[model samples]
Target: MKTMESIENEEAAPRAEHQTETPLESLASIASVLAVGLFVMTFVFQNFEIPSASMVKTLLIGDHVLVDRISLAPPAKWAPFTFYRDIHRGDVIVFLKPGEPDLFLVKRAIGIPGDHIHLRNGVVYLNGVAQKEPYAAMPTSDGDPQHEYNPYRDDFPSIPPDPMYQVTASWQYELPQHIENGDLVVPPGKIFAMGDNRPDSLDGRYWGFVPRENIVGRPMFVYWSFETPADQIEKQSISERLAFMGHILVHIVDQTRWKRTFHLIR
Candidate 1:
């Protein structure tokens, strides 16, 4: 028996007041989100920026990649849920440089532990078999003369390490011990890595073996890429770095390599 106007008025009346979150509660919620993000970045994933063209055509300079820190990590009793696996040949890896422990480097694992490795005119022979490496680049006539075929660089340990080739002092002494029948044997708990831009890269050939413990993780994909100069990393001064940062902001829209965004890394 209620009139339409009276029913409408009753329906429009406020039902209940909702409680607003207190400032302290809001802060706690934010803290929880930050904690989760920190844990994920620290233990599960890590961000790395490509500073050199060592892995060019695969990973270019200024390519910001996300590395999966858990997969290649040693298995842990407490973190049984994590999927851990051993490093394998042809896997692109990020690791601390053997001699320069503080420097991080990215390269392709050409030879794993217990593998015999050697190079003949830029061809990688592993375990007495020549590998079909399509990613590797050999020097061309148009390329820099310095990257041209050399005895120590192309022929590897067979020609022996020469002082002019920038071979590490320790590696020069240790190189002979590992060579057997002209092939350099990768000892246990070590990896032989090389760059895709073979001629330009100063990798395992110039240094030495990468320790298993030095392995950080494998890059999953490139999150972002910019057309950065090869020498940008050399600018260590604060003013130079700040100037480049400003330049990036101004040219970001035009210089960003949009096509390479989210590209998968091999």
Candidate 2:
């Protein structure tokens, strides 16, 4: 009985002494956690904040969204476990702006490669069929001046783009090359995207096609949303930014759209 008890004490002493991790071991554990977090944020997922009203009811300004970067990315042989798929029509995608590579824009894919597209009276016609876009905020007679129809905006590609409009010079030169039988034909390795707020959005019509490689990811859901001004993104000065940060800190609870928390993005 004594020998048995002695043996048990000897076994228990080592475990008790080792139970409390050394300082080095504790730091190593913390570093491992940080490494995993960094990897997930950089490659697996990313967060973005909407700064414009282009998407309107679909995605409002100041809405922070979680983006799934893996699914839309090109499939890698090393990461065979990750799923990948091609972008389809009507899928809202986040991508770098074609002309301005630094700027990021989110818009719904209207035309994929080889699609014949045109707009008549603000209605999108694809492959000779008019699309039923319930999400699009079309022009209405409700007296909102922003929604009023303009010939160049409503009847797209039919009217020659003028310099008075915000159409890019590069797009004006390339636009005619894609027009066929009064329809804009999407070429290979490119996509035509437009905003949900048709009248207000400065999108594909004004610029050009989005390259397949330029797309970043699809937004999975809105993680947080705050009521912010349309011009908040334009405030670049340090003082102006600090003022807004102070405003957010004070109004974080009340200004936050609690209902939109975790709201799934379509």
Candidate 3:
């Protein structure tokens, strides 16, 4: 006859064996997790970083943001609940660079398709009304009267097209076609975007309208922020990039902007 403890152990052993997942079940579980992850990445969200000071004061350089891909999805007649909402004025968005499709950029939507957009001394006038932008970052003082004045930056539509100030050869010719009266009339399928740091940003004013298809998503929040040099992330060699990564690891604690972590991006 077996002891009571031995008898209990024998019974528990078979139960444990029965509870073990089969290989097929294990594979299915892994597949389910992967599928969910893929779906989220493809349709729900994506990671983005503030690579430049174009959106300064609103979003700082080194701020890592999560773009909500779901919000920018194309509308579907059958799936009203799942379709993307319309892009609105003052909405900050991440999009593919109009001139360079490979590059991504972030800017505030100042005008939607069909809206009249213009600027007077860097103050944006949308639909003939001056839209108040509390998020915009302005310079403390106007510097240097002799610094080659860019009429396109200060006063929009008032200045004729200049090859030197235009973003691209095509834009130089196409910009005039969109001007109606004194405002730039956004085409039927494009939106006008601009950076909050108006004086420093190279944006739609230089390039052209942002195509609806070029828009990726709206930034939801800053997941992480590390105070870094403005030009540290610009195009660099592989060795330089590796050096930067190592530097980040060493000084993460010192450089991390703790207050900005999990900060909701407007």
lDDT of 2 by residue, 1-266 (tens): 57988999999999999898999999999999999999999898999999999998899999999999999998999999999999999999999999789998999999999999988889999999999988898887778877888788888889888777789999999999999999999999999999999998999999989999999899999999999999998999999999999999999999999999999988
Per-candidate alpha-carbon RMSD to the true structure: 3.2, 1.9, 2.7
Model 1 over residues 1-266: C-alpha lDDT tens digits?
99999988777664322356778999999999999999999889999999998888899999999999999988999999889899989999999998788999999999988899988888989888988888888866666795777888888878878778999899999999999999999999999999999888999998999999999899999999988999998999999999999999999999999999999998
Off by over 4 Å in 3: 1-10, 22-28, 76-83, 139-149
**1-266 per-residue lDDT for model 3 (tens digits):** 99999999999999999999999999999999999998898778899878888888899999999989877868767667875688998899989988688999999998898899888876778888887888886443457442234577768767876767646777788899999989999988898998988777888888888999998899999999988787787758999888889989999999999999899988
Backbone clash pairs for candidate 2 read none
For model 3, which pairs clash?
A: none
What TM-score number comes out for model 3? 0.89
TM-score of 1: 0.92
Which pairs clash (backbone N, Cα, C closer than 3 Å) in model 1? none
- Candidate 3 local Cα displacement, residue 249, angstroms: 0.7
Q: Rate the local accuracy (lDDT) of all candidates.
A: 0.90, 0.93, 0.84
Ranking by lDDT: 2, 1, 3
